[model samples]
Target: MRAAKSAYPLTWRIMDALEAFAAFVWPARFGRAIPWLMLAPALLLVGLLVLGLWLIGDASLRTLDTSTFLMSETYTLANYRRAFTESLFAVVAWRSLAGSLMVTAATLILAFPYAYVMVRTSSPVIRKLLLIALFLPFFIGQVVRAYGWLIILGNQGMVNEALSLVGIAPIRLLYNYWAVLFGLVQYMLPFAVLMLAPALTAIPEELEAAAGSLGADWLRTFRHVVLPLARPGLVGAGLVVLTLSLTDFAMPAILGGGSQDFIANAIYDQFFRTSDQGLGSTLALLLVATGSLLVGLVFTLFGAGTLAMGRARQ
Candidate 1:
């Protein structure tokens, strides 16, 4: 009649040992350093990021010599110049940017209602169902979900079969600009709902009731009170969705069928397909800059909002 052992006894023992070892190494006077010690992992990650940036920047200045199939030793701005001047790059950049904006807007629009209903519903069953609907897709990997869309939207797939039942010919659905955007909006919807749910919860239901009591209709109350208060959440969700959509590689690659290209796909082509490290490095660095600039721009306009956990403005 022995008690069951801990599920991860070895891991627990190792952790305890590490704690003891850490305590042993520290001097009594260094007790005050515990706070700083907590930041070691973050500092290490930052150091690695800086190192990576330095490497990519160095590679970007070196052009690939097609003649020798090697990167040039001498640093030059040829890669940067080409990136700025190229029409292909411009097209890909524009597509990614525009798609990202559209996806963010559409996802937020769809997510707001979902989040509102989830937050406001009184019944536990409804709340659970909504949560399942919101989170189930997250468990499915992005690439897998993209493939699922392929199955549903394929010319000979379910939609086509349904169309055939009604005497309609099978139409092309996948591998188009709208298809890509549609997939992106679907992919980003869950993220938007997760972001917005908390913000909706933070708003007092009584205020909404009070608005209704004061002769304001549902539309007016939503427009003035709910909308204004939810601004932070919307901005935060929009920023997340925009950045993710802009940099997505799989959706554009798989769904576009090599026709539509995003900046990320372009970067992948440069690095892997073309075997041009210089060009790839240039694109990677520019992508980082673009994403940073966008985030900075959002912060400047919206004051960081819920992305900063409602404490940014405070």
Candidate 2:
């Protein structure tokens, strides 16, 4: 046995030594705890999050005493009421909700085809190029991307310059709702494509070929087969895009040029701009609740498959 151990490769010997040390430190009887032990960090993080939320909730119940520039001792729902009643807050909320829906729809529509081609295409070069394009923007910061759009869509930018050569005037493309939405869509496309790719890959090409052999057209095959199989990815991507867009700040701030603002921007204005921590806490809590409710709705309607694999089996 010693000779046999000595004959093993150096890498294997090291692995054996590590295993032996681990077994000695942690006995086999406690093996079941290993899973829970590994989860300790996550549990700690969740506990901290809950603690922070509790503190915020407590703060939200109190009102900011503007006269003294401090929070009041008595609890009140005034902050919550103000959030819903204020026209500025209401408009920002509506804009965020509307923008989120629009961005989600556009992202899914644009991403589905890109992801489908990336997964289904036989050409490695095209796949590589597509992957490169998708990930290249992902490496760049969202703030940087917003600034890039400003350069490209500005009055003196490349787009307007090209139009000038054709005897057209520079259009007001930047600093609007559409501009903010465009920035969000551009930022989210990669994430949507990434989420959808695995789902598309899971679909067997042989199924499509089989459908074709049975005289079904490509569109019919895709509608009846591929689309159904890819629902999990679609739902997941939609949820991700919706939540992100709803809470986005940088795009609206940078691209919308002070006129357009999302819910996150509103939250920021409360906390920092106006120095109203109570209102900020209320907004933050509401945003969390809204996101949680939306996610719960998706899960309730679509099952866990909206965020996981195994939807096809269901």
Candidate 3:
């Protein structure tokens, strides 16, 4: 008790000195201008987001006429009811969720080996070239990329032509579930690589070497050492792919045709084609909520901090 009392005053004195120094430095370096400089971008982003939401909400609140094909201000939940009951919006939402999950799972399986090879390879030049190729597709606009898929998957396109030459009938590839999945996986592959690469690279070589020294084979070392170390990256990559697929509009709009309608496309139709702004907003909000919940669940299950600590003990 006496020793604790003696330390308490010293701690208080040190804290006071730190506080005084902070006050002097804060005014001298930041004063009024620095805070504004730091805050401006954040404030601007918030303002824009709020404004956009407000505009969408306002548009949704207006009533639409089926007779004259006109919209007017008579706020109601009829649009929301119609979205739930009449439009098969619920089915679209389910499809979106399922498609996102499938794409995320497939991308994870595909990307893990590539990411592991990229990080673990001895050839730096080859790794650099491969990374460049992986990310190169991102430089092209999404619309162009989607159209490229269309050309490749179309009846008279490269894929069909090659299949025709093989004497097999041209497959019905375009405007289908497979086409949408292919496009989504291609679009999100770069993200998976980016997320997984850093985590793989950060794993200490000593851990793998130690495992090997203990008579563990390469496969065993990977199973026991590398995978556990990279679980966080796996989870993070899945979340990115899942969220992107969930909110995706372009690929579904272009590749899905009538067969692959997602929630985002449904929302677009409501706002633009049907002019049911309120229902669109509600759908948008639902998408946001669902994405957030899934992301939160992933983090809860495989957070980086927990996984890191688990690996450290091994």
My TM-score estimates for the predictions, one after another, are 0.91, 0.91, 0.81
The C-alpha lDDT values of all candidates are: 0.92, 0.92, 0.84
Q: What are the per-residue Cα lDDT tens digits for candidate 3 across 1-314?
A: 35766666877989999989989878666676887989999999999998987777676665677786676657776666766686588788888999999999999889999898888889999899888988899899787999999899898889999999989898878898888988999889888988888888889999999999999999999899999878778877888889999999999989988768999898888888977666778778778779989888876776643335446335
> What stretches of model 1 exceed 4 Å from their correct place?
1-24
lDDT by residue for model 1 (117-230), tens: 999999999999999998999999889999999899898889999999999999999999999999999999999999999889999999999999999999999999999999
Model 3: colliding residue pairs: 60-277, 60-278
Clashing pairs in 1: none
- Candidate 1 or 3, higher lDDT? 1
Candidate 2, position 307, lDDT: 72
Q: Residue 214, candidate 1: how far off, in angstroms?
A: 1.1
**Cα-based lDDT at residue 309, candidate 2:** 59
> What's the count of clashing pairs in each model shown?
0, 0, 2
What shift in Å separates residue 112 of candidate 1 from its native position after superposition?
A: 0.4
Taking the tens digit of each residue's C-alpha lDDT, what string does model 2 give over 1-314?
35765578899988999999999999899999999999999999999999999999998998888899899899999999999899988898889889999999999999999999999889999999999999999789999999999899999999999999999999999999999999999999999999899889989999999999999999999999999989888988999898999899999999999999998998899889888999999999998998889889988887655476564465
